[model samples]
Target: MPQPMGQTGGWESYPLNPAVHPGKKVVFQYTAEMEVKTLVFTLIDKGHE
Candidate 1:
Protein backbone atom coordinates (compact mmCIF):
# COMPACT_ATOMS: atom_id res chain seq x y z
CA MET A 1 0.00 0.00 0.00
CA PRO A 2 1.09 3.58 -0.60
CA GLN A 3 2.23 5.50 2.45
CA PRO A 4 0.67 8.71 3.74
CA MET A 5 1.48 11.86 1.72
CA GLY A 6 1.79 14.93 3.97
CA GLN A 7 3.90 12.87 6.38
CA THR A 8 6.60 13.72 3.82
CA GLY A 9 6.99 17.27 2.62
CA GLY A 10 5.78 19.89 0.11
CA TRP A 11 5.97 18.32 -3.41
CA GLU A 12 7.63 15.11 -4.44
CA SER A 13 9.03 13.09 -7.36
CA TYR A 14 10.29 9.55 -7.24
CA PRO A 15 12.31 7.56 -9.72
CA LEU A 16 10.37 6.94 -12.92
CA ASN A 17 10.19 3.39 -11.55
CA PRO A 18 12.35 0.79 -9.82
CA ALA A 19 15.80 1.56 -11.17
CA VAL A 20 18.96 -0.53 -11.33
CA HIS A 21 21.13 2.49 -10.69
CA PRO A 22 21.00 4.68 -7.60
CA GLY A 23 18.88 7.82 -7.44
CA LYS A 24 19.83 11.25 -8.71
CA LYS A 25 19.46 14.65 -7.06
CA VAL A 26 16.39 16.36 -8.47
CA VAL A 27 15.35 20.00 -8.56
CA PHE A 28 12.46 21.55 -10.41
CA GLN A 29 10.12 24.51 -10.48
CA TYR A 30 6.69 24.32 -8.92
CA THR A 31 5.25 27.51 -10.44
CA ALA A 32 6.84 30.68 -11.65
CA GLU A 33 5.21 32.49 -8.75
CA MET A 34 6.66 29.96 -6.29
CA GLU A 35 10.26 29.20 -5.44
CA VAL A 36 12.28 26.41 -6.97
CA LYS A 37 12.93 23.31 -4.80
CA THR A 38 15.67 20.75 -4.56
CA LEU A 39 15.30 17.12 -3.50
CA VAL A 40 18.09 14.71 -2.77
CA PHE A 41 17.26 11.02 -2.73
CA THR A 42 19.45 8.26 -1.38
CA LEU A 43 18.91 4.64 -2.33
CA ILE A 44 18.76 2.68 0.91
CA ASP A 45 18.22 -0.66 -0.75
CA LYS A 46 17.09 -2.31 -3.99
CA GLY A 47 14.28 -4.28 -2.40
CA HIS A 48 16.76 -6.46 -0.53
CA GLU A 49 19.78 -8.03 -2.17
Candidate 2:
Protein backbone atom coordinates (compact mmCIF):
# COMPACT_ATOMS: atom_id res chain seq x y z
CA MET A 1 0.00 0.00 0.00
CA PRO A 2 1.15 3.54 -0.83
CA GLN A 3 0.90 6.22 1.83
CA PRO A 4 0.29 9.86 1.06
CA MET A 5 2.97 12.35 2.12
CA GLY A 6 0.34 14.99 2.79
CA GLN A 7 0.43 18.68 1.79
CA THR A 8 3.48 19.69 3.86
CA GLY A 9 6.09 17.20 2.72
CA GLY A 10 9.31 16.86 4.68
CA TRP A 11 10.34 13.28 5.36
CA GLU A 12 8.49 10.01 5.12
CA SER A 13 9.53 6.44 5.75
CA TYR A 14 8.25 3.20 4.29
CA PRO A 15 9.18 -0.30 5.30
CA LEU A 16 9.85 -3.02 2.73
CA ASN A 17 8.08 -6.31 3.26
CA PRO A 18 9.86 -9.64 2.82
CA ALA A 19 12.91 -7.44 2.85
CA VAL A 20 15.17 -6.68 -0.11
CA HIS A 21 17.99 -9.03 -0.97
CA PRO A 22 21.04 -8.69 -3.12
CA GLY A 23 20.53 -8.70 -6.91
CA LYS A 24 17.06 -7.28 -6.35
CA LYS A 25 15.73 -4.00 -7.67
CA VAL A 26 13.39 -1.61 -5.87
CA VAL A 27 11.28 0.93 -7.71
CA PHE A 28 9.48 3.95 -6.31
CA GLN A 29 6.61 6.03 -7.70
CA TYR A 30 6.30 9.59 -6.48
CA THR A 31 3.82 12.36 -7.29
CA ALA A 32 4.33 15.92 -6.12
CA GLU A 33 2.90 19.33 -6.94
CA MET A 34 6.32 20.94 -6.82
CA GLU A 35 9.61 19.79 -8.32
CA VAL A 36 11.33 17.03 -6.35
CA LYS A 37 14.95 17.81 -5.70
CA THR A 38 16.37 14.98 -3.61
CA LEU A 39 15.26 11.52 -2.56
CA VAL A 40 17.03 9.51 0.08
CA PHE A 41 16.79 5.96 1.40
CA THR A 42 18.03 4.67 4.74
CA LEU A 43 18.48 1.01 5.70
CA ILE A 44 17.79 -0.03 9.29
CA ASP A 45 18.93 -3.26 10.89
CA LYS A 46 15.82 -4.80 12.42
CA GLY A 47 17.42 -8.18 12.88
CA HIS A 48 18.66 -9.51 16.24
CA GLU A 49 21.31 -7.19 17.59
Candidate 3:
Protein backbone atom coordinates (compact mmCIF):
# COMPACT_ATOMS: atom_id res chain seq x y z
CA MET A 1 0.00 0.00 0.00
CA PRO A 2 1.04 3.58 -0.58
CA GLN A 3 0.44 6.61 1.61
CA PRO A 4 -0.30 10.14 0.39
CA MET A 5 2.44 12.71 0.13
CA GLY A 6 0.10 15.14 1.93
CA GLN A 7 -3.31 16.76 1.56
CA THR A 8 -4.33 18.06 -1.88
CA GLY A 9 -7.32 19.60 -3.64
CA GLY A 10 -9.23 16.26 -3.92
CA TRP A 11 -8.44 15.33 -7.53
CA GLU A 12 -4.77 15.73 -6.85
CA SER A 13 -5.20 13.05 -4.21
CA TYR A 14 -7.16 10.58 -6.32
CA PRO A 15 -5.41 7.43 -7.39
CA LEU A 16 -3.69 7.77 -10.76
CA ASN A 17 -5.43 4.44 -11.60
CA PRO A 18 -8.15 2.93 -9.47
CA ALA A 19 -8.97 -0.54 -10.81
CA VAL A 20 -5.55 -2.09 -11.26
CA HIS A 21 -4.00 -0.19 -8.40
CA PRO A 22 -0.57 -1.07 -9.74
CA GLY A 23 0.90 1.76 -7.70
CA LYS A 24 2.88 2.71 -10.79
CA LYS A 25 1.41 6.05 -11.56
CA VAL A 26 1.86 9.45 -13.13
CA VAL A 27 0.95 12.75 -11.47
CA PHE A 28 0.47 16.08 -13.18
CA GLN A 29 -0.08 19.53 -11.72
CA TYR A 30 0.03 22.92 -13.38
CA THR A 31 -0.97 26.44 -12.49
CA ALA A 32 -3.77 28.16 -14.37
CA GLU A 33 -1.47 31.17 -14.69
CA MET A 34 -4.68 33.14 -14.35
CA GLU A 35 -5.97 31.40 -17.52
CA VAL A 36 -9.22 29.54 -16.94
CA LYS A 37 -9.31 27.83 -20.35
CA THR A 38 -5.90 26.25 -19.86
CA LEU A 39 -7.01 24.88 -16.51
CA VAL A 40 -9.93 23.17 -18.24
CA PHE A 41 -7.56 21.23 -20.47
CA THR A 42 -5.45 20.22 -17.53
CA LEU A 43 -8.51 18.71 -15.85
CA ILE A 44 -9.59 17.01 -19.07
CA ASP A 45 -6.23 15.28 -19.32
CA LYS A 46 -6.51 14.14 -15.74
CA GLY A 47 -9.68 12.23 -16.59
CA HIS A 48 -7.85 10.24 -19.28
CA GLU A 49 -6.73 7.87 -16.55
Report lDDT (CA) for all predictions: 0.41, 0.44, 0.33
Greater TM-score among 1 and 2 belongs to: 2
State model 2's lDDT: 0.44
Per-residue accuracy of model 2 over 1-49 as CA lDDT, tens digit each: 2445666333344555544542233334345653453454434453522
lDDT of 1 by residue, 1-49 (tens): 1222343334444553455544433333233334434445544454654
Q: Please state every model's RMSD to the true fold in angstroms.
A: 7.0, 6.7, 10.7
| Top-TM-score candidate index | 2
Q: Write the per-residue lDDT of candidate 3 for residues 1-49, one digit (tens) a residue.
A: 2222334221232334545553434443433342212121222244455
Better of 1 and 3 by lDDT: 1
TM-score of 1: 0.27
Model 3 TM-score is: 0.22
- Judged by lDDT against the true structure, how good is candidate 3? 0.33
Q: Single out the weakest 10-residue window by summed lDDT for candidate 2.
A: 21-30
Point out the higher-scoring one by TM-score: 1 or 3.
1
